[model samples]
Target: MAFVTIRDVAQKAGVSITAVSQILHGKGRFSNETKELVRRTVDELGYVPDSRAQGIRLAESKTVGLLVPDIRNPFFADLVSSMEKMLYEKGYSTLIGTSAEDVERQDAFITTLLGQRIDGAIVVPEGAESPGIRSIIDRDLPLVFVDRTVEGLDTVPSVVSDPYPGIESAVETLSQLGHRRVGFVSHSSLESVSVNEREVAFRAIAGRVLGEDGVAVVDCDNTFRSRKDALMELLSEGVSAILFAYSPDAIAIIGLLHDRNMDPGTDISVVSFDDIDAFRLMTPRVAIISQQTADMGRQGVEMLLSRIGAKRRRRAEHRRIPTVFVQRGSVGVAPPERRM
Candidate 1:
């Protein structure tokens, strides 16, 4: 089939090619009637803009690249969808890359995206030492970090969820419900600023609500066996209630509880971060510290767009979306026997 061109649309609509181009790009002023006519003609002719040709002419691909650590994580999936929708509305397409929580893979994806000549990038970097992040910094390409920021990368803007609000609420609620001691299961194996922030926030809040001696902490790797061991450790610490900073560990713990014929709420109260579907759909709905993924996505896109449209690179800024605690069946009254 012959590819329909803008020239064909211009001829059919009785307008100059520039008129069609301006209308399609939402650029130069055009009468409503003229714009409608051009759009109708373009639709009838099935004329799709040649992004490559346009990029060569305008020096912009009109595309944005997004990198996430794990797309399988419902939070990232929702974030990607939200960002893609907003970018599309702004006349830009999104190229998505998943790193699978690997530093080398993260750099590789960044390199590949750079090759695409994306106008800007929003990355959830694995860490600050990534050469890929440095390349973007050296080239001065518009870049925004989402979910977490790199250590000492003061020049790059970031949007992350504020854990204090949700952590404070979760600890207070548990304390009020007779949870004298609470354990925090942290994903310490991963070098993530946000994860560390969550851990610190929990310790502070738990200490304030239940006393410093009430706080129990354990590090867990991203593995079923490790999470199981962490849960056992927290139980041995005599924690009546427990919070998992990572959602995967919470899911694994729920299964492990079932294997031991223990109930999540009755035998031990449970709470975790991220309001993903898996948590909501569990037998006893798991309590969540929702990071507001939609808000994070919107903020990231807005920040990246501002950088991309600016005449000169502006001073980097950081934005935080406050997380909220969601009460669920998983957070039942702390067992009297388990209470300190």
Candidate 2:
């Protein structure tokens, strides 16, 4: 099949080629509706601007780096897809890389992208302190953090979900349903802003609702075995409902429960912070605290491009999109005495 081009996009959108160019450059005098029409047309036609040609026109590399902590999780994969689509529409190529939550690889990926002379980067930070992140700032390369922010690196622009409201909602829902014992499961790393924020919120809200000992927390490091162990630990602690801090962890815990002839909605309630497609098809749909992941990805790319144009920002910009509570069948009222 022939490659789709800007002219084809313009023709389909009923706009001039110049309008398409100006819209892509974010300088079009066209109305917002016209621009959106062009965007939707570009998306439908799967048009990608030629990088070498656009590089010459813009005098830029026309390339950007997208560094993700891990792609195995649907959340990160969806995030990358959203950012990639937006950046592609804006006529930039993405150099995608994954660190698998390894700090060393995070630095290495940065060095590699820098050597490639990429114009900018959007990263999901692996941990709090990173020399590579600092170097990116020192070089003044356009950079933005998605989903998480490096600890103490408040000077860098970031797009993250404010999880407190969702956490509070979950706590209230569980409490009103007669859940007095709830467990929290998550990664041991707290350097990432989202994990730290969610954990703090859970402690403050769920802690108060359930009392001190009523709440159980199991923080594990890398490895599926560790995650499973954490979930098992929480179950052994006699939690009436389990709140998995991540979607992947919740899925894993469900598999473990099934293996032991346990049911999620009845044997013990389960809720996940992130939503997955499979959650809906389960025997009892899993409750979810849905983050504004698509918006986060879009804003990250927008901030990176804006920073790239400004060369340096006078003040670091930060945006925290709110999460939505999605009710499903994964939560139920606690039994009178509970059964282990």
**The best candidate in terms of TM-score:** 1
What would the per-residue lDDT of candidate 2 be over residues 274-298, giving only the tens digit for each residue? 7667788788899999887888888
Poorest 10 consecutive residues by lDDT, candidate 2: 50-59
Candidate 2 wrongly placed segments (more than 4 Å): 1-58
Worst lDDT run of 10 residues, candidate 1, spans 50-59
Compose the digit string of candidate 1's lDDT tens values, residues 1-340.
Answer: 2245678888899999888889999999989999999999976765556645542324567989999999998888999999999999999999999999898899878767765667899998896568778777776789999998899998999999999999999998998899998999999777899988999999888888889899999999987778888988987899888898888888888898899888888888899999899988897999999999989999999999998888886999999999999989989898888777
In model 1, residue pairs whose N, Cα or C atoms come closer than 3 Å (at least 3 residues apart or on different chains), thus clashing, are: none
* Clash number for candidate 1: 0
The alpha-carbon deviation from the true structure for residue 145 of candidate 2, after best TM-score superposition, in angstroms, is: 0.8
Q: Would you estimate the TM-scores of all the predictions?
A: 0.83, 0.79
| TM match of model 2 to true structure | 0.79
lDDT of 1: 0.87
